[model samples]
Target: MHFSLFLGPGVRGPHEDRPAIDLMIEQAVAADAAGFTAVYVGEQHFNNYEPYADGLTMAAFLAGRLPNAYLGTSVVPLVLHHPLFLVERANLLDQLTGGRFILGMSGGRPREGKTWHKHDLTPEQRSRLFDQKLDVMLRAWAHRAGDQPLEFTTDDEYGVMEGRMMPASYRRPHPLFAIGTNTPAKIAEAGRKGQKVHLGPFDPAGAGRIAALYRDSMVEGGHPAELIEDNLRWLIHTKIILVGETDDEAWDVAERLFTGPMVMAPWIRRDPGQDGWSLRKIYRADPGPFAPAMGVPESQGAFLHRTAIVGSPETVAAELAGYRDAGLPHVHARFIFGTLDDPEVFRRSFRLFTDEVMPRLGVETIPGPAGDQVQIF
Candidate 1:
């Protein structure tokens, strides 16, 4: 199993005297020293949702520290920027990191905290735009000057661009690319393109369907039949984790840290209307069961049960073992929330997980592209 550290404080305000960037760097430094495989940050904007609006810049900052771990953007929203710029920046990051950069892509969510004049795009139009941008980026990275023209025109909203991709990406055809989403069609598309997938934390049954669709399409897209199942390791799953001596003790830590009265920022926040719902609504219509918990203790536990792994080492191993058996390629452990009152809590969580559970599960090092590892096509 591939183990990783996920850091992106969802909330960024008034919690501690230390600056948000400093806190994140501190966490990254600690995780690197402890030997976590990779570190990923999410792209969130405007609202105090995440300290950094640009995930690329944050990853670049971490790359400067140049830990042994790989650096990735949990996802960079492709719709918000021009593809040429996005690809150029991505290529630069790959060069800067010497091929260790993983470009995680996404179409973005509804209810973004920031206001974009292009926010009025219809669902169908947005999908088309995402496709166009992705095509442009891939062409640039693939150096497809013969297959595609260097200059192209896009919608007025994004504008036109022309330029040659001079500095080639460190990795041929660019560094690893992964498209993350829960939608079956998207997963199938990823399989068709031979790319990795940052799959959502769906239930086992839902995940099964995703894996099946992706694999079938992958084979149909010309991948060798023998390589089909072996490539399932790319379904990078996300989970919040905390360890303790026992289940009860673990629950206490979860409740105290996660469901505090002041209500720390959400570990993962996705608003409604971003997926094509009516924009007038303020709160999410599909708040889902967990989103509307209003920061209550019971609700927090329910949320964790829905998406986290919190328990003793033995308990955590039992649940995660089931996940591995179910065909997940990797696990991204989100250790701290925006509201963590102190940094020590996160550091301790990391130490315990690595010390106790990793050995039992036979997780010796960061994930490599072998042994059922999900391939980034």
Candidate 2:
């Protein structure tokens, strides 16, 4: 089982004094020192959803510090940028990182906090655009095989290479590419193309449903056996995590630091028109059964239950073992969220996880592809 730390803080409001970038560097360095497999950052913009607006650049910045760990963008919205630019940047990072970059991409959501002139695209249009842009990127990366410079033209997008795409990616064709989405059809398509996937938070049973779909489609699509095996091995699932001496103690810390701020930030700030409801609106209308006691809606508790692994080391390790047993091997854990007033709380939980939970899962330090391990400092 591979564990990746999510380095970006999911902040929702202005916090110029938070020193988020400094803390992020600390987390990356800590993860590398503790032997985490990889570290990832999500691309969120305009709103203070995430401290870093560009995940790829952030990954590049961390690359020098993470000698023992790979770097990845959890989900870079593909529709927002031209394929040529995206591919060039991805290739540069792949070359500089000694082939340790994973480009996880998405079609983007309709309700992005950042406003683009092309915001009016419907879901279908966005899907098609994502597919088209991905094709262009793949072709550009593979153009080295041909003698002629690559030339291509798409709707309102065109590129005529002056010479071969410079600095070929360290990984042939491209660095490891993974699609980020929970939609079954998209997941199946990604599988058919022999690509890995980053799924939303789900239990073993829920994850198995899509996991099976991806595997079956990979086979049904007639991809080679090795590619199928590789795809399955790299399946990623995201989760929120916190560890303490006991479940009750962890829950106390969660309630004190995580729940309320989460409710206010990312959840409440979501577009009210999104699915015709927002968490803030629903909470105002009715705080369900345990809301009064929990100080947030029962819905938020349920969300946490479905998406997080909060407990003592033993309990957390058991749940993760279940995920590995059920074929969800790569866990991308978000250890810090909302406006955390205490960085030590994050450091303590991270220490507990790496020292206790990670050992139970059999995580061991492995050499990077280049066979060099450099300390961050």
Candidate 3:
């Protein structure tokens, strides 16, 4: 399966003596050398879960640094930005990356709205807004003089004036548009549009439902049966850390590193009433039973395994094999999670995965621009 790396600058740690930007660059450099296919950055604001307020900027920096790797946003909160401005930023990044940019759009989370004290929109409203913004962006990218006109007016001395975005996107028809959400309708929409879907750690049954929904929607949308096979790219995001000699050793290291101070500080912690519920509760409350006991009993491990690709290279490989069998082609490994402070350990795990697991799976290691390979200690 194709491997992608997900970078969370804020979640990596607080902005201390070493700026997060530098660490981000270092991670990109390492990931590129490790021969990963793509690197995705998430858009998080006000909170420390991810420090990068603007994913487009970080993506541009990565694009410049790692020429061989594809750069993408895990999901941009489209509802937060004006469609025209967002489209412009996307086009610029697309050009900067030389057509290696993938646009991942989402309706955003309810907590994010609360952060800005913005009105909490209903799911339907958010979806509608998402659709409108997407439409505007698509049109702007495909803009020509006679095609259509997008008009915007501001309160001033003068009346309204017509306007249209200039300098369309470099990619013909537009850069890749992938929908990032767990909603069935969104997944179906991606299938109908022949775009990719981002799947995270969910129960195997849930995964099957997502896949089936996408496939069914593809057919219902009048897409050819094989369209799903041709263009359907499943981007699975999972917490993964490669272990060394024994699974036990890996578990010990993971628990210590993940639960450390730098990694799970106030920023990463969930605040009541502010950070909504669901995932925040999971993070706020115990990381769950399996998480506390690093050993991870089979039943609990099975549950976690559904969402995270952890353990030794062999173990991770076996799990990945199942995903491959289930029609997932792309896997986005989130190397940073919880509160892991030691970069060296992270590097080691990543290196081991590259050296051991990927090769056995018949996945070729394509170096990023720097052509650096990871060496396990």
In model 2, the runs with Cα more than 4 Å from the true position are 12-18, 260-298, 364-377
Give a tens-digit lDDT track for model 2, residues 69-139. Answer: 88888889888888888888898888778888889899886667137665788778888888888888888
TM-score of 2: 0.85
Tens digit per residue, CA lDDT, model 1, 229-336: 545654677777788778767666765665432233345443433444321121213334543222323232234344667778898888878777767746777777
User: What would the TM-score be for candidate 1 when compared with the true structure?
Assistant: 0.80
Off by over 4 Å in 1: 12-19, 144-149, 156-163, 225-231, 260-302, 364-377
Extract clashing residue pairs from model 2: none
RMSD of 3: 8.6
Is candidate 2 or 3 superior in lDDT?
A: 2
Q: Tell me how candidate 2 scores on lDDT.
A: 0.74
- Best-matching candidate per TM-score: 2
10 residues in a row with least lDDT, candidate 2: 287-296
TM-score per candidate, chains pooled: 0.80, 0.85, 0.79
lDDT of every predicted structure (CA atoms): 0.66, 0.74, 0.63
Per-residue error at 53 for model 2, in Å?
A: 1.0
